[model samples]
Target: MNDNDVVRDLTLDGNAVAGLLEEVFGADMTTADGECAHCGSANAVGALRAYTRAPGVVLRCPACGGVIARIVQTPRGTLVDLRGAAHLAMRR
Candidate 1:
């Protein structure tokens, strides 16, 4: 599909992922820091523009408008793709 076709489906923000992230990462991940792989924009995951309506959830950078992450659920398991993020800094 075209880029617009994909982006037109975005309907939420990183805040929408708090619960799911807690399940997988064991804590609130929305507040974590993330750097964009495409444009090097560094910001909190909560700051990323999130689209929750689609076959999967898509997160994009607010500064450069590049995709930062994608989360999909399948029959086997939940798949989280982070290739769009160059750095995912979590609190220790």
Candidate 2:
């Protein structure tokens, strides 16, 4: 399948989204203010606002304004990638 097809067909539930957020942020999905394990910054709020607005959307760090992470949900579980943040340069 083409990239467009894959993007159009991806589906995720709330539970999966929550799991992804937890895995990435190490806190509840709705709360904010978690430590960014990468940069050691106190501004890692889980970015729940960004997540809820766009369920599978990844967000950049508001403090550093860098692409520090992503969130994805699948049948297996939620996936978070802190290493994606270009500025942090740290892994979870």
Candidate 3:
């Protein structure tokens, strides 16, 4: 496939994570604040970048291109990884 096709296959907006994050956190997490582990920049989870290619979805820091979260859906279950995020602020 061409580069455009590849990008189209893998690329997505951060808003795509809203539903999954809500399922995980039991609330709307799109407006939640998160800090990038790599650059320390802070922003809303909905403002990050999203990639949905390989076997799962990946959310990246908009500031330094750091991976903020990863979500993989398997036959048995879904796995979520947030190792690249330093901190997340939940609403009160």
Candidate 4:
């Protein structure tokens, strides 16, 4: 997708977007290594591991721990938010 497309569709806050990406891409359970596009970090063991929990799924820089934006796929096409079963928390 182009930058304009991303700006229009995934305009939500960064953290929310991160969570959404994680859910959509199965980041939490991912076992593959991914490079952080921002800081060029190569520490993403899984999809979720590439992000930081503090900022609510903010993509972390593997080399410098910087935050980066991530894109995820969905039934409605590519999305920037975590709106799947994985992102949902169980209620007590």
Candidate 5:
């Protein structure tokens, strides 16, 4: 196998991380609205495609398949990368 051949074994819906998201964000983020920075497609967080087979969790846009977010856990703390998301709107 080559390093380029990333084996993504499983694909799940964002809803699968409901408990994790609530633990991290302290709210139900699955219902949040997010805009993809790459494709500019707006979608609910629950609708984003989720891949958890890697070291971290990856959320991808359903429209363009652009990465929307990455959540990784480290010794010190958890790392959240949202560069792929233009903005995430949480309901009050």
Candidate 6:
């Protein structure tokens, strides 16, 4: 298997997390603009590839496959790690 195959097998479009994002962000954020910190790739939050088989949701840049964000739900609360994202512009 190749990188593309692996990626395909492990990921889904960011839309899969629409409800989770709305819950975390307090609004529909699927159409939000996002910039990847790792590769400088820009795309809609909904356009990013999402890997949900982990303990949390891992969103990645589709162009470069760099992680853009990670959202985890813990008993304490939700943990949003955006270290992989340079910017996220959500519409009002």
lDDT of each: 0.84, 0.49, 0.85, 0.42, 0.90, 0.91
Over 4 Å off, model 3:
1-10
Tell me the alpha-carbon RMSD of every candidate: 3.6, 9.0, 2.5, 11.6, 3.3, 1.7
Model 3 error, position 14 (Å): 2.1
TM-score against truth, every candidate: 0.82, 0.39, 0.83, 0.34, 0.87, 0.89
Candidate 3 C-alpha lDDT tens digits along 1-92? 99989765666767887887787779998888999999999989888889866688899988788898998888899898999999999877
Candidate closer to the true structure by lDDT (higher is better), 4 or 6: 6
TM-score of 1: 0.82
Full ranking by lDDT: 6, 5, 3, 1, 2, 4
TM-score of predicted structure 6: 0.89
- Using TM-score as the measure, name the better of candidate 2 and candidate 5: 5
Model 2 per-residue lDDT tens digits across residues 17-76: 555556765656434444544455554344422433465665545444454556677778
Model 2, C-alpha of 49: deviation from truth (Å): 6.9
* lDDT digits (tens) for residues 53-72 of candidate 4: 33334444334544444454
lDDT of 5 by residue, 1-92 (tens): 55434443367879998887888899999999999999999999999989888788999999999999999987899999999999999999
Worst 10 residues of 5 by lDDT: 1-10
Output the TM-score of candidate 5.
0.87
Q: Which structure among the candidates has the greatest TM-score?
A: 6
Off by over 4 Å in 4: 1-22, 26-29, 46-56, 70-92
Per-structure clash totals for the candidates:
0, 3, 0, 6, 0, 0
The all-Cα superposition gives candidate 5 an RMSD in Å to the true structure of 3.3
